[model samples]
Target: MSTISLTARALLLDMDGTLVNSDAVVERVWRGWAERMGIAPERVFAIMHGRQGYSTMAELLPARPMAENRADNAVLLAQEVADTEGVVPIPGAPAFLTAIERIPHALVTSADTALADARMTAAGLRMPDVRITAESVSASKPDPEGFLKGAAELGVDPADCVVFEDSAAGIAAARAAGMRVVGVGARAASLAPTAFAPTLERVAVTATADGGVRLAVSP
Candidate 1:
């Protein structure tokens, strides 16, 4: 399937794992948190992807009070933000972003404002003019709140936006928002998207002089 051919006026994107590679840092911090709380790190990691820090902590340590979970998440997230030495833009992220820069694009991340800003700054990617971070929505991914909010912020209907995502939760959000989605990684593709590519580099979007777009996928 071709990504450029999707008829959309705007693009909605997920941050971590989709546009930027921050898995290492995320896993490291979550692992430490799990160890400290006496939970299995691997189990913690499984549910952490595509979720807000507070949400992940709460789910992983349900016995703890919400206040305690929030405090622990804050400490861990701060450490992750402080240690951004290895976080980098995902492969083809620069090119993909450049391709869509001329068009309306909004970041719809599960990350809260602070972590989103920190990750974007670490990757040196240009910040989106419109963004729907964790704080912007009452519900997170798989609920479509973030993507819906992003499309609204861009002044485009949800059906008129294409979402690029790398996790099942993100893909589910996009689908629930009534938008077509292009999965950017293996796991995401398995969830069934409009199309799937190994990376953004394998996908291309071209805008024609007639104000229409063409999406192309390279095998």
Candidate 2:
């Protein structure tokens, strides 16, 4: 086990796997999509996490048109919203969010507004005032556009922000944005996060005298 401490002007967070536990919904939708696309379900699982549905569709069916990908993504979004069966907050997520109540933060997610809203609702999480959804960005994670946009909206420089992320794509996005990242899952460590924790339960937040926030993570 190890501990990490950092101070930042703002926090950029990822939605699905980071804040809300939507593994079941993600797997269910993508598995069905894989079957339809004739790709192996496990293969879809490998590339789909932390990516926009359209991006995943395009990746899975490279020869498909953008229009076709968009249409398929729309269907996936609807299915995800309608089937929020195991969605809930990740461990310690509730208190972690509550502690950061007065801090500047934004949710950067590959999910669209409808799916984001539905999953958050299913998880009993209130959306932060600032959010970047699929509709908010042209490209998805590992592209850095969403994270940079999120920092821009928060009025913080990318270098001064710390991201909390659970997916490989999200961590890569944060790094590409020039922000340090606290990887939020067991697999996160292999991605070279500034710190890795199994769950948010091990994280503690405190406000500094200069108005920045401090994070102490023990894993």
Candidate 3:
């Protein structure tokens, strides 16, 4: 496959599937919740990734009170924070972060500050100076709030930003923010992001002379 090239004034990153692989903890916690709630596990799993816990709970139990979802979401977040046995940095993630240290970039994740810190630390990844965590936004992924906030914080036009994501919600959020997306991993392939890569390992980043970032993504 030909290499896909992209340029941007800044880069927006998603944490869970993009930088850290926390699927193990996510599945364990959400699966248990599904079992207790008598909901189908597959349905719960379908919308779990790349979203804030409370948002997932709300979607899974739409008729349930927001208060109940928020309460349960808090409990689930705590459980995820405490369990990091399988959390690890995505392939090339450490190098990718290092490569962008001097470039304009911000983490746009659905995780709250605590969970973000825990997972990033567990994966041994450097946290970006600018981060839009769950607490920073009133709306979740697929809403564009987080990505828009990240672009604003980075002082870059949304159209000049490139997003790296691995889930449907994240890609949609980036698109809604009017940014180009370099979809990462299997989850993003079918989402029709501007570009696609199987892993961060297939992506190369460089600083452009115009104070932008350039990405060369392999198929």
Candidate 4:
């Protein structure tokens, strides 16, 4: 496909499937929960990505109390943070991060502060200076709060920011926040992002004269 170019004043990035590959750890932890809950694994996996654990639990077990879901989520987060054996960066993530290091960017993820740190470290990726972790927002992905908060923190208008995400919830959130989205990885292709790339390897970033960013997205 021909390269598609897009411009933005700032970037909002999702951590899990976008930059870091942590599917192994996620499956290990959430699969067990799925089995214990007697819900089909496929059902759990479908809605798990890009959402906080508690949110996922609340969705799956609608009758469960929020307090219980929150408590279980804490335990799951601890388990995930302690086990980073298979966490790794997505292809071209290091170079991509380096290319945008001096520009305006922030990490907006469902992982809490500690889990985000652990996974990023395990993947050998530098955590962005500005982060909107689970703790930083009252709502999770698909809510638009985190991305909006990220734009505000970077002093960029929502319309001028581009969100990089790999899941339905994240993409929906970006769209709700009034930002264009660069969908990353296999999961994002059918979600109708503003632009789609198989990986960061297909996305190139350059600073513009207006202090924004120009992205060249390739198939």
Q: lDDT of candidate 2?
A: 0.89
Where is model 3 more than 4 Å wrong at Cα? none
Q: What lDDT does candidate 2 reach at residue 218?
A: 87
RMSD of 3: 0.8
Considering lDDT, which of the candidate structures 1 and 3 is the better prediction for this target?
3
Alpha carbon lDDT of each predicted model: 0.81, 0.89, 0.92, 0.95
Tens digits of per-residue lDDT for model 3 on 1-219?
689999999999999999999988899999999999999989989998898877888888889999898899899988988999999999999999999999999999999999999999999999999999989999889899999999999888899999999999999899888999999988998998999998899999989999888899998
Candidate 4 regions with alpha-carbon error over 4 angstroms: none
Candidate 2 residues lying further than 4 Å off, grouped into runs, are none
Q: Write the per-residue lDDT of candidate 1 for residues 134-166, one digit (tens) a residue.
A: 779887677888888888888888888888888
lDDT for predicted candidate 1 compared with the true structure: 0.81
lDDT tens per residue, model 2, 1-219? 668899999999998778888998889888888897789998888878898888887887888899999988899899998999999998988888898889999999999998989988898987899999999998888899999999999999999999999888899899889999999876576788998888899889999887789999887
Q: Considering only N, C-alpha and C atoms within 3 Å, which residue pairs clash in candidate 3?
A: none
Instruction: Give Cα distance to truth, residue 87, candidate 3, Å.
Output: 0.4
TM-scores vs. true structure, each candidate: 0.91, 0.97, 0.98, 0.98
Q: What is the lDDT of residue 13 in candidate 2?
A: 90
Report per-prediction Cα RMSD to one decimal: 2.0, 1.0, 0.8, 0.7
Q: What TM-score number comes out for model 2?
A: 0.97
Better of 2 and 3 by TM-score: 3
Candidate 4 residue-wise lDDT at 21? 99
